[model samples]
Target: MNSFFSQPTLQLAQSLIGMELVHESKEGITSGIIVETEAYMGPEDRAAHSYGGRRTKRTEVMFDQPGSIYMYFIYGMHVCFNIVSGPPGKPEAVLIRALEPVSGIALMEKRRYSSWKRSPAQARKIMHLTSGPGKLCQAMGLGLELYGSKMNKGPVFLKENKKIPASMIEAGPRINVHYAGEAAEYPWRFWLRGSPYVSKS
Candidate 1:
């Protein structure tokens, strides 16, 4: 609830639908069009890591500036990325749920599948490239190494591409937060309508 955010977490999530998230990595650059996002309101939303003002080493970056990269390991094997939101002292973030590959797709395939050399049929099934958080992180070479870093000052950066009109966006409850009590029903997830690259719906 401050000026540094530019807008609320929910609004920011919706606005990111058409923006490009680019990664300059050792293999090469890979970029994607953000097609789905979910916002976790600071301290109050049960689904948020900072809910009830809980703060720890891993959750610290969520209290930083709006553009800090918040990456965390989950399910023992996957990494999920989030953009810290809300102003300093207020912990909130927007989770990038899914992306649509836009550039360096071969390199993305290399990173994710360890082989860009795919059969003609394999190449056509590109929806799995960046359709989910963990999948996109692997495709873009994002990991825990970039945790707590500034998005605009490192290998990862986001840029505006084009605006997705309001009519093309949809909102719904976030994925996999069924244990968050009544908060599970909060319609905080936003995604481009009819985007096949979205993880769900």
Candidate 2:
């Protein structure tokens, strides 16, 4: 599966849409089909954490081989998951922005909600379970412990799924990266059309 990510940053980001992300744990198994993604062009792109060749303990994993997990904490709270992309030392990565919950809905709701108690009608809003990057990470039991894990094998990994057609994919500028100046205008974000699970439309 590592080879799956060995492509150009933008290409890999678009390709990830519709693939399945699965997690296994003592609690249960949780899975989702990826529906949205954003690419960080690295080095030259001001939006990238590895921009300007900034290498720290945290950013080091982005320089690893393709398919390495690059999880990070943001806003002093939320955890965002990224998959290392491109060749070794390139530092490019694809941010998994949203997912459509596919399996273990109950376990996901338990993890997402404080009380794990909800009416059947209220529970129907399953799209909210894994609708965003941080939410999906929490629902799937992913955290710093899974950082740097190989995506090809682990409690957390990507699985093959039905291919998404090019026509169904929508591309636009990345979200919440206004600080990137001109780079913020780059159309690196991709998502499935009409997917309620997308982090943003």
Candidate 3:
């Protein structure tokens, strides 16, 4: 399982598909098969937070060893989870974009909607329970508190689920990265082909 992170960032992003990302908490255990991911290569990729080798307190974890968790806050309200895919000093990561929930659906739905009123207009469906980055974190109980932690440590970790055929995977431009200029066109985002849980970009 540890050797899995040794792959290149682009490969890691695609390889993550079909693997089960699990989080065990007091609430219960919630797990999902990774269906979509986006790779961010730093220093050169303008879409990356570590572009030009910029390292601040928020991005410090990106420089850590491979498999280190590099979670961050986004839009001042949502938490996004990234897995460091590094060669020790390099700042590259794979953002977990979406997941297909396979365990604790009831709990996930509860965690996802219990916090606020379920607006009828939202039309929240089980397929959308963990369809996006922020939604997955909220459903799985992931937060900034787990920042910088190793993937195999604590209550959250990945379990090998099944192997995804290469033909069943596809790549495209990352979502919400138009500000990256030319980098926005890079086909760094990977997803399971025909997966309904993939984020709608």
Winner by lDDT: 3
What TM-score would every model get versus the actual structure?
0.92, 0.94, 0.96
lDDT of 2 at 92: 90
Number of the candidate with higher lDDT, 1 or 2: 2
Task: Please identify which of the two predictions, 2 or 3, would achieve the higher TM-score against the true structure.
Answer: 3
Candidate 1 regions exceeding 4 Å error are 1-5, 115-124
Residues 34-146 of candidate 2 have per-residue lDDT tens digits of 99999998899999999998999999999998899999999987899999997999999999899998998889987878554565445447878888889999888789887
Q: Which runs of model 2 end up more than 4 angstroms from their true locations?
A: 115-124
- Taken over the whole model, the C-alpha lDDT of each candidate is 0.87, 0.89, 0.92
lDDT (Cα) of model 2: 0.89
lDDT of 3 by residue, 1-201 (tens): 777897999999988999999999999999999999999998899999999999999989999989999889999899999999979889999999999999999999889887765565575788889999999999999989999999887888899887999999999999999999999999999999999999985
Total backbone collisions, model 3 = 0
Worst 10 residues of 2 by lDDT: 115-124
Model 2 Cα displacement at 65 (Å)?
0.5
As a whole number from 0 to 100, the lDDT of residue 77 in candidate 3 is 93
Ranking by TM-score: 3, 2, 1
